[model samples]
Target: MPDQPVDQTTPRRGSRLSVDDWLEAATQILVDDGIDALKISRLSARLGVTKGSFYWHFTDIGALKSALAEHCRQSQATAASRIEALASLPPVERVEAMARLLSDPRRWAMESALRRWAVTDESIAASVDQLDCRIFAIAISAMRELGFSETEAHARATTLLYAGIGYVHAHGRLNEATVDDLHVIIEILTRR
Candidate 1:
């Protein structure tokens, strides 16, 4: 979460949580509990702060939710820059790193939480869809780095990305994919 400048009237010292702090607390509540659990009182209490602090940052819960949705959109807006960074890496290394999408458990959990939230909110759902397309584009970039034609890149990238998505969403209930499973996948996907 990007840090917004603190309100001037807010104390510069002890327990003075910034706007970013509130948003992060809200996100934790959203991911760990659910959207319904995102009450201002609950979040303030969780952060060991007062409601005054939250109010200092946001007018109300709706504003906070809107901010969260906007944050989600802004966070994924780095696809082009990310692709450029990936492009700088050796082709084989880039492909290997991109194909290891399921390696981060925390990221998977957050994405899964956002997906669940999307089911009930159109704004959030749109954000998720845009994020999905952006991530898919990055995967496609990775495949192209391996010298695959656009059509071939789309097919392989789609297959690999969808597989990673499925694994992430189902990961809470199912056993995690083993290192060997990932090795076989990385080997197959990176094969020229």
Candidate 2:
């Protein structure tokens, strides 16, 4: 299970933590334990600061969650840009580019965490849904340009996004057969 909610008590000692520090601490907590484990008190304690400091940076837990969501969104945008750049090579090259992008450990970890958090948080779920829609739009456009009908393009794009998410989340759970399976999936999905 995730760590208990943050301890919201007084600080142990030292100067107050900055917003960046709080965000970093929160991310660490989320990464190590999970969203359920993130508590304001525990986060403040983790930063060696008091819960009051958290108020300085955020009005409430919702505010802090918004910040986390923005951070994750920015990180995803950066990764998506990198993926797009690599995918610009050739149609064949795009497949490997996407595979490499989805297979990265850090990206997978962050996306998985964001996805899990989105499950219990409506705001986060909305944000992720928006991002997913935008990504699917891009993929659909690409598919359309590659000769698929509009409806077929959208369907393929949605399938690719779902498969990509599943691929990254189930990384360690797969064996060598996974790559072979992915190759077949790609062939079927990307074929004209």
Candidate 3:
């Protein structure tokens, strides 16, 4: 039999979308639009699934919203883990990875949306703040591991993280050549 054409608008028969699919779609919508646009009807239309499908996965829109917040928390945890894992690599490699994270404009879209939502939602603002503090702590610890004094570690970590935050807020990203230039600076920092 010849392969059947797949419809992009809807899922195949007997196919079921998982919770991750729903959550990912919701997060994308949250990023592309805003919290106000995160309604059940809108999400259903966006996902090209029925409203009943949403209820099968979530009790209500409020449930989905709560799940979305938790999903964001989980994402933050994953990012923190990635940052911590960078410690295993050499200093130049580590710095390059950090630069990639900062310079990738698409990397921080979800967090950017969260920040916009945070302006009105105090709870979300707190979550964003908590993530910031956690990243800063990880950064400072990484710097200390590199043999910097306490104050110096704090300063380098601050510079690294603030560069990322500033890019996210300013919607800027660095090119590969600039990132390559950063390696020379990292080489300087890591020399004993």
Superposing all C-alpha atoms, what RMSD in Å does each candidate have to the true structure? 7.0, 6.4, 4.2
Clashing residue pairs for model 3? none
Residue pairs with colliding backbones in model 2 are: 6-39, 6-42, 7-41, 7-42, 8-41
TM-scores of all candidate predictions against the true structure: 0.75, 0.70, 0.73
Count of steric clashes across candidates, in order: 0, 5, 0
Name the lDDT value of residue 180 in candidate 1.
79
Instruction: Say which prediction, candidate 1 or candidate 2, comes out ahead on lDDT.
Output: 1
lDDT of 2 by residue, 38-59 (tens): 8899887677767787898999
lDDT of 1 by residue, 1-192 (tens): 999877653344356687787778778888888787889899877776677878888899999998987776665455334534665667566656654543567667777777888899898788777766766776777778888998988888788778777877877799987767877876687678
Q: Arrange candidates by lDDT, descending.
A: 3, 1, 2
State the local distance difference test value for candidate 3.
Answer: 0.74
For model 2, the local distance difference test gives 0.72
Q: Where in model 1 is the C-alpha error above 4 Å?
A: 1-14, 78-80, 141-152
Error of 3 at 134 (Å): 3.5
